[model samples]
Target: MFDDLISLCLTGSPPALPQDWWLRWSLAPATLLPLLGLLAWLLARRRRPLPLVGWALLALALASPLCRLAATLAAAHMVQLMLLLAGMGLLVLASPPRAHMPRPGPAAAVHGALLWLWHWPPLYAAVLGHAGLHVLALALLLGSAWWFWRAVLLAPPPWRGTALLALLATMAHTGLLGALLTFAGEPLYAAPGARAWGLEPLHDQQLAGLLMWVLGALGYLLAAVALALRWFAPGHPVRRATPAH
Candidate 1:
């Protein structure tokens, strides 16, 4: 059992992990840590609301390195995405005694530029290929949004709010940003020097950009509705002053 846990957490091997395998293996522990906490909370108190920090932690998982592998392998991406949603979904469902505890909710005032940063604009420089980072960022953004949608429904207040907002923003940002591609006179990502994804270089990147914007629009519409549900719910922490009749 110990060996299996190690394998699952470190390299999916019987302990002979390759250098790249270590990354996925490393992620499993961080993802499982919350489950450990949830287990402890459940054992201590059979029934009680989960803390808000737990929800925050969950959002972090969906958006960051936790799903890094998912962005690399199409098949692995689907599997990891499901695992992410399931893990976080179950944790939120129980709402263990230690959860639903809030920690530094959304800022009182929002900045347009910071909001832009949250979109995490393409570095446009670090990319080994002009379009590599852009393509990669889209994969991360869209994949996380899809997986987190299920988790959002199962998440606690304010968390659901933040997740929903992030989802909405990602969609919008991708849309506006993707415009650069759709309108560029020539293909930027599949040029002679650009990296190729088994296609004519830049072909995949151009298509990817179109899909990113189109999908982003769809996510925005769906997430907006989800946010509305939270807005209407009584006592939702993210809700602002109720509009007067």
Candidate 2:
């Protein structure tokens, strides 16, 4: 059991690990330590501390090594992606520095392009094969996702309509991509170790696609509604810039 746990923690490869694999005490120092440092710095500031909910979400997303094991299944991988997006969204929304968000149209286009490019077979393979590349992929995805959500949901009032359109566009594009993946006759990527988890490649791909299509698009639609509410609410106070820390 101990040997199996060690193997599971050491690599994203699979041998159908036991449930305890998620509870292992392993640390991804390269990922976790910097985040912890940031949390500490935020708390030490004399001003209002950062949001605890945001920090907690990020900590759970980055510090838990279970993501590695989860990647063995495509459906599980989608869940990991959703968790990272949620964490990053919370962190960005709740951060003290209020940078001006980018225009939603260009931001959405860039985000969609990145998603397609990264999910290409060669890139996904590289991510799985090299630990460093895997980290880089996650970083890029998190950053892009943060930018996308910020533009869609947090844009200033003047750009709210444009933001809504951008969100809708993202929903359409991503949903289309997901549909294609779901209906594809064969597995898109021949990822190693997928079979070790007893996953049927085609079905796994479909499941991943459905998650992206339904859940992802639903998230965008909800954000659009939230933005619309804020924009049209009666006598809403003009949102001030976030105070400097």
Candidate 3:
């Protein structure tokens, strides 16, 4: 019964993505609670707009054919991996620009979140099972983690400190979703060579859903940690002073 409802909602017309992870992720303030902390730190010092690595991460997440490569190991996976690494290489060199500086409250929060949403999730479940695509997604995320570690996480101190935790969440969320589908013996998404990889179709679908949660949560947490560290760290330049009578 519930399955019927899910199918209907997801396929009411070729589907338009279940829930908007990108939407909320973009708004850095509300979604990324710690963003203000970092902004304060950078702004207090009167530094040039500090670079924001999220944009680079966003781009790499999008550039791939699958955008997320949630398939059954394939050639496209390798290509996608190569491209992700390459993009990360470029991000390291080019450096992302900071938000258009800060602004008033509620309004600014909305704007920042919008910026974060551009980081695409690829929604690979739809087409990633070509065997070619599977290998690509895994490799890209794992491989890029290394290349991006320094440039993305390290470059931004606070952002760096919390990135690992957030990243793990992203991976776990999606993996969990996929796992659930597998356990239920239902295939939300299918890969041609799933059996070869020893994953039943239903199991493959479960993995995809799991991956969604994994990456989605991780991406979310990464932004969150970066923002949090910026917020709570002691002696932060942004700490407001008490109003004097």
| TM-score per candidate | 0.37, 0.80, 0.33
Question: What is candidate 1's lDDT per residue for 1-245, written digit by digit as tens?
Answer: 11212223222233221234324433345446755675677566554344334444444444343333323322222233334433443444454223433221222112223323322324322232233453454345434433444334434454555656655665566577556555556544312222312444345445545654575466556656856676567876642322122
TM-score of candidate 1 against the unseen true structure: 0.37
lDDT of 2 by residue, 56-124 (tens): 666665556455555566666666666667666666655442556577777788888888876787787
Report the number of the highest-TM-score candidate. 2
lDDT of each: 0.41, 0.67, 0.37
Off by over 4 Å in 2: 1-20, 23-25, 41-51, 96-100, 191-198, 240-245
Worst 10 residues of 1 by lDDT: 103-112
Model 1 ranges with Cα > 4 A deviation: 1-31, 34-171, 181-197, 229-245
Q: How accurate is candidate 1 locally (lDDT)?
A: 0.41
